[model samples]
Target chain A: MSFEISVSRRLGQGVIALDMAGGDGITALFGPSGAGKTSILNMVAGLLRPDRGRVAVAGRTLFDGDAGIDLAPERRGAGYVFQDGRLFPHRRVRANLLYGARLATPEARATGLDIALDEVVAFLGIGHLLDRWPRTLSGGEAQRVAIGRALLACPRFLLMDEPLASLDAARRDDIMAVIERVRDEFGLPTLYVSHDRAEVERLATRIVAMPQRDTA
Target chain B: MSSFLALTPDDWEIIRLSLKVSLVAVALTMPIAFGLAWVLARLRFPGKLLLDGLVHLPLVVPPVVTGWLLLLAFGANGPAGRWFADWLGIEFMFRWTGAALAAAVMALPLMVRAMRLSIEAVDPRLEGAARTLGATRWRSFLTITLPLSLPGVLAGAVLGFARSIGEFGATITFVSNIPGETRTLPIAIYSALQVPGGEEAVTRLAIISVLLSLGALIASEALSRRAGAGRGGHVL
Candidate 1:
């Protein structure tokens, strides 16, 4: 499915104007720390409402300012993985994985929990960590689990916000491989945010740059 | 020594009453504190500053003044009190329920403050992550926000309970110190101090109060440390 996003927002210290549109492939949002890359992903995920813009994924209007249509993040069907894993600390890994599945509508449950859970776990190679707590996982392992948790939600598109920024170079490579595999295997559109040009070059099929805002 | 041994019944009753009052206070204020903390930490509304100030007003107001306000709002013949008594047969004035209400009011600010800090400490990005995972706002809070903020919520409860256990001005002004009714440990201690040769009884009660407060503080610190360790050594 295709994903189209054009958003303009006034963030911390400047205005962020982002205009981009792409189809089923990894679209890299590349820029410096404050270049509004994350903001654009957030807009697409419906986490941040743009002052003026339209976000459409696969011809479905997720947000249209003039049309007064703004779907909440949950209804947008976009999988988002944050830089930090942000896993539920109190829940076991298995419980955290099922959290999203539990929120699925009744119609979505016909697919069966065991099938979805096993598929995500096998795909992410986190089968052994299911009973473990989030605190027990390394940086790379946690990110993998985070990705698995997001995918289990059955999203139409994936929005990743600097998911590899916190890992070491070796760990970054490891998680990067998983990300690419997911993108290719699922055949779903992916939007990745990153400051590393090498990562963008390696993973992204399309590049969207967010310009830095002027301080004065 | 004989008098102290003879008052065992009174001592047990006071201790039991204190625990009951603190537990009720903590229970009554927990959900409210959670709701307020979420609003303060996550959403930015027009009157947010005013609401924040109001939530914290009890902390700055003298306990006696707070007790007076509660009496005016919930005493017999008062608007809410009269309606409650007429409709639900609930009377709070000069009763154990009144003591719990006073303690809850006194303890609310500390509860909200601790919870607010912890909720604010949580990464908003995580909530965003939960949202993208098909969890609605309320669901996201229940699954992600609440669990992640558990340490802080526990700390808030312990702090509130400790504060309630020691609450004096408000409890006395609102409920009065009636044995087997509204008299908590602190109230009992205060009463013991009023009589001749009551020094020894006061000393024993004082020691118990100190131990309980210290225990709560230690528990809260341990919980916070565990939460921090769970987050990969990052203190949230």
Candidate 2:
């Protein structure tokens, strides 16, 4: 399995129990809004810890309650693009893209993506947007830069949490194309979260439905 | 311009001393205050409430009380003050440095409050986003939280500087008014007010003080607004 996650964590007063495994291409977490889809992604990314369970990606144990193996988010190398496109507003697009690349681990540099920063930039068609700040970019353009930034990290896997939710249909298609291209060329598994069946149908190779959990 | 204020060396020195003292106080307090504000904004320690209360203590306490506390902690006979004098040749008793210490203490609460408000306003999601992109906690803070909070930092510094310039009771109590040393513009005006037929001198100095404070406020406001325009704003 490229990704194996069986975890339970509390959200306020309720518990979110997720158990799933996947291999290859985009594994879409299909569900309605607030079904803890984003929570699963957060656990895989090591941004949230599970109360008792193991999360292993490509045989690298990211978190294991039994073995006491919990890596920091930075060490996990699982890139995550938030729904709202949390690009650093004060930084220019180029700087935001270079943030992870500048801090790339020795292991990351050994990957095929070592010199692919320029390639990613070209692929995302963000060269024209490089000098501008995030506040100047449209939602579609910002989403592209956000994806480009995560790719520059050479992450073990990519977790995209409804990256197209905030865009119009046309703009959503624009970002969807870039995401498809990244999935094809980046050589990493992508767990795409979404509530829309059409979006998942268009993007996912294999689908795992998120059981609607009560957040109350 | 009055003949008493025709660029007289004494008048100019007073203005220069006030600027120097206030600037030095701001410089000394900025980094420390930023650290304190960030901690207060981000962390939740056991004594966090107590620390917050202590920081704002100077704001509520009388200026003279703060001056007395400074004198107790930083006076020549005090352990910290004596160690400084013996080891580093630094003295705070009745010196210009002492005036700066007083001003910094008085201005710290304002700086910390402004910065904390700005820091709190920053989206924590940005820092979390940064962390997932291979940035450590410190790295995320420097890249995301710190830069996004710049407007607050600048706002705090400007507020601190303005407060330092206007500080009088704490400064005079701690450092005492001395010619060409601890005697800043406020002290000069006060001295002029006490003397018979020194009305013109007092009036000229008071005008300069008002202008300086107003100018600083205006400049800082503009800069803060520009800095804040970046965050929490809708993109086209």
Candidate 3:
């Protein structure tokens, strides 16, 4: 499956134009902090529309600036894992995981949601934390839940933006193992973003380095 | 703390009538107050300051002045009062409903203020997260925003109820003290003090009023606490 995106944005740092092309496995967008990495992922997720350009996945167009076609985030079929896990404080772990999954159509879950949920529960080892409040969770536990939540949405692809930045070294390694397992378990193509060289070396099938910020 | 059995038929009538008027007043204003609070908390529009000032005028102005304004706008001789009475066959002139209207007006500001504070406290990011998770904007508001802001709603409602129960100057000016019709507890107490040998009756009614107002305050605290904890969210 081919995934390609070419986007140009005018941020305060100056104009940034990013382009990437990849097939299968984890394509890590390696960059320094504030190098427009998260912005690129946000554009693909339809969270932020690029000033100009197009994005496509597996021959389906998700956004095309020339045609003025931009899908809403919910219809983009892309799941996002933020740097800080955005768990709903009002909901339990199970409820947060199931929130978007329940809205998924039958075709979205080709493997069956129950089966997918069970697999995610097994894959992430979050089965025991289902009924607990989000506040009770450790940073590592919350991030894992966030991943399982994204996976349950049955997204066409996953976009992870510094998912390990907030964790301790031990927790970071722990989540890396979970991420590796997720990629291997479903063969799901992931576009991972991080500034850490070690993480890129450990997980990137292809590394796309971002250009430095233009001072103008 | 006189026993309910010790209360004479007249004393019971005043207490029951007071409860009925205040309850109806709260019911009339709850949805409207919440709507205004939501608007103030979430959106901005032209003349917002003017609307806010008008809503709070009753709080700052003398209660008698507020009563006069209500009468001028909703009295039988007034345009709105005339339209409502002629079209809907509803008259507020010397009626318990007029007293209720005054009570609602006096209590509305407190309710809106309390609810607005709570709404402002709720984290906007939570709603944003919900939207990204397939919930429509309206859905996110109902499922996420509303529940998170409920502690304010509970506090507002209870404060409104208490304010309604204590409404005096406005009710007397708008509806006057007509026994078994427009006379509420405050009006009854005021009337009792004017007549000889009505001291015993006043004491009982005053006790009931104090008891009811304190009960409302205590219940609001308990209910708001439970709502905050039960929802498992941070209150503003």
lDDT of prediction 3 = 0.84
Mind giving the per-residue lDDT tens digits that candidate 3 earns over B1-236? 44643888998888888889999999989999999998998889999999899888888999999889889989979998998898988788799889889999999998888777778777776775665566667878888888877766887888889999999998888888899878999899999999999888788889899999999888776656755665432222
Candidate 1 vs candidate 3, lDDT winner? 3
Clashing pairs in 3: none
Number of clashing pairs, model 3? 0
lDDT, candidate 1, at B97: 90
- List of clashing residue pairs for candidate 1: none
Collision count of model 2: 0
Candidate 1 lDDT over residue span A1-216, tens digit each: 477777788877788887777867898888899777877888998899999989998888999999999999888877778888888777789987877777776643443222388888988889899999898999999999888887877777788989999999999999999998987888778888999999999999988776776554
TM-score of chain A of each: 0.93, 0.96, 0.94
Give the DockQ (2 decimals) of all models: 0.71, 0.83, 0.45
CA RMSD per model (angstroms): 3.5, 3.0, 3.8
Q: Ten-residue segment with the worst summed lDDT in candidate 2 chain B?
A: B227-236
Positional deviation of residue A138's Cα in model 3 after best superposition, in angstroms: 1.4
Q: Write the per-residue lDDT of candidate 1 for residues B138-185, one digit (tens) a residue.
A: 888777778778888888888888888998998899888899889899
Per TM-score, the best of the predicted structures is 2
Real contacts recovered, all predictions? 0.89, 0.91, 0.29
In order, the Cα lDDT scores of the candidates are 0.83, 0.86, 0.84
Model with the higher DockQ, candidate 1 or 3:
1
